[model samples]
Target: MIAQVQKPIEEILEYLEGRDKVVLVGCGGCATVFHTGGEPEVKEMADILSRHGKEVLAAIAPPFGEFTCYAPWSSKRLSKYRQEIEECDAILMMTCGDGLQVVRESVIEGEFGLLKRIYPATNPTGHMGGGPALFKEKCQQCGECLLGKFAGICPLTQCTKGLLNGPCGGSQDGKCEADPERDCAWMLIYERLKKFGELDRLREAEPMLKDYSQMTRPRKIEVAPLVLE
Candidate 1:
């Protein structure tokens, strides 16, 4: 899951400068889970903007819920608010960068040039751990899975220094030197491998450098449709 934090109100105010009319677009997916871009947050932003003497034309959550990041779905959902969006000088998106980009694309596709000024109200922090309440950064989404070799532990993310081979010399008493409060990731991996009698695997091969090509920006995958002969 993507994790996000609300942008500072001062920054929001600066972004809203000279835009008297605005529309607030909230996300119901990860943003809602992180308490950043949910309906309540949208309403709160609207109230704050109103207090600042800005007219909030509308505060709405995409009808497609978690799929708001998809341009087609977002365009359809936003179409209902065409009048409100057109009348507004700018749109304040209470979501992560992806959602903001999707909304902006949707607006462009819909020929709503008046709503070209799009702003993000939240800053994406990182990919979060699984489950509803775990907002901790667990995965880096490197496009390569190395958990099999590390005994299910992610050295890249859990380790402060992102060491893949072993615990750094700075590790003292099983704690990381970079952050004394956190246990060393290599230590945890060592213990887990030792318990599973797979400690020998560590010496089997040298750790290879991460393949950054797999994590190139603007990455995408295509699923071919099935054709019956």
Candidate 2:
């Protein structure tokens, strides 16, 4: 999931300095999980904007599991607000950057064929895993899978320096020197490998270099449509 946090109200207000009519849209996916852009957040934002003298035409939020980043889902859900969307001077997107862009490019500009100023209210930190109580970044989406070689621990993400060959030799008492609050990633990997009797893999390894060319930005994929029985 994409982890995100809401931008400060001061910053959001600055973006609406000259705009009056506003439409607020919230996400039901990551933003909901992070308490950044859920239904309640959208209502709160609408009230806040109203108190600030900005007229809120509509406040819309998708149901949980309906991601605002998906073109079809967002377009369908937002179609009912076409009139309000067109009348609004600006849109306050209480979602991650992707959701904001999708709403602008796919829903507003593509479907409606009308250009409107859209602003993001949340800042995405990174793709992460773990939920219910907490979330932590687990992958960088580098377009390569090396977890099999490292006993499922990703050094590129967990290690401070993304060291692949071995530890940075700066850890003390199993704590990372760069980040004293966290245990050394390499130490964790070493312990895991030792427990599995796979320590020889580390000994026979050489320094590794990541092929970043595979990680070209704006990557896309085309998948076959799902067939329901």
Candidate 3:
């Protein structure tokens, strides 16, 4: 999931300058998990704007499973607020850049054809994994899978410097040199491989340089659409 944090209220207020009537849109996916754009946050934002002398035309917050980044879900939920959305001077997206752009391009422009101004209320940190209470960045989406070689550990993301081969001889007492508090990624990989009697795999040399040709931006894939029986 994409990890993010809410932008400062001062920055959000700056975006709302000269705009009286505003519509707030919240996400139900990563934004909710990160406490950035959930239903409660949306309602709180509405109250804040009202207290600031701004007229909040609508506060649209989808449930925990309805993602604002998904056009179908957003379109369906937003349909009820069509009049308010069209009349609002601005739309505040309490979501990551992905959801914000999707709502702006796919919903506002593509579906409604409104040249509406949409602003993001959250700043995305990065793609992360882990749950319930704590989350951490675990993947870089490097377009290459190397877990099979590293005993399921991703050195690129886990390592501070993204070393492809092994530790940089800076680790001390199984702790990372970059961040002494963090465990050394290579040490973890080595221990896991040794436990499984796969230490020889580490000796098997491979290309050290990462092939980033396929790591282009705006990557997309097309698959058959979901059809319910």
The candidate that wins on lDDT is 3
RMSD of 1: 3.6
User: Over the stretch 102-165, how does candidate 2's per-residue lDDT look in tens digits?
Assistant: 8999899999999999998988999999989788888888888878878889999999999988
What would the TM-scores of all predictions be? 0.88, 0.93, 0.96
Displacement of the residue 83 alpha carbon in candidate 2, Å = 1.2
Worst 10 residues of 3 by lDDT: 220-229
What TM-score number comes out for model 3?
0.96
lDDT of 3 by residue, 1-229 (tens): 9899999999999999999999999998999999999989999999999999999999998889778887788888888998998999999999999899988998888888899989989999999999988899887888889999998889999999899888889999999999999999999999999999999998877688888886877887777765422
For 1-229, candidate 1 gives per-residue lDDT tens digits of 7788899999999998999999898987888887788878888888999999999998987532555676666666787899888788888988889888877865644546553688889989887877766667788888998899899999999999887777778999999998899999989999999999999978865456788999898987766633422
| lDDT assessment of candidate 1 | 0.82
lDDT, candidate 2, residue 220? 72
lDDT (Cα atoms) of all candidates against the true structure: 0.82, 0.90, 0.91
Worst 10 residues of 1 by lDDT: 106-115
Better of 1 and 2 by lDDT: 2
Superposed model 2: Cα runs more than 4 Å off: 204-207, 225-229
- lDDT for model 3, on a 0 to 1 scale? 0.91
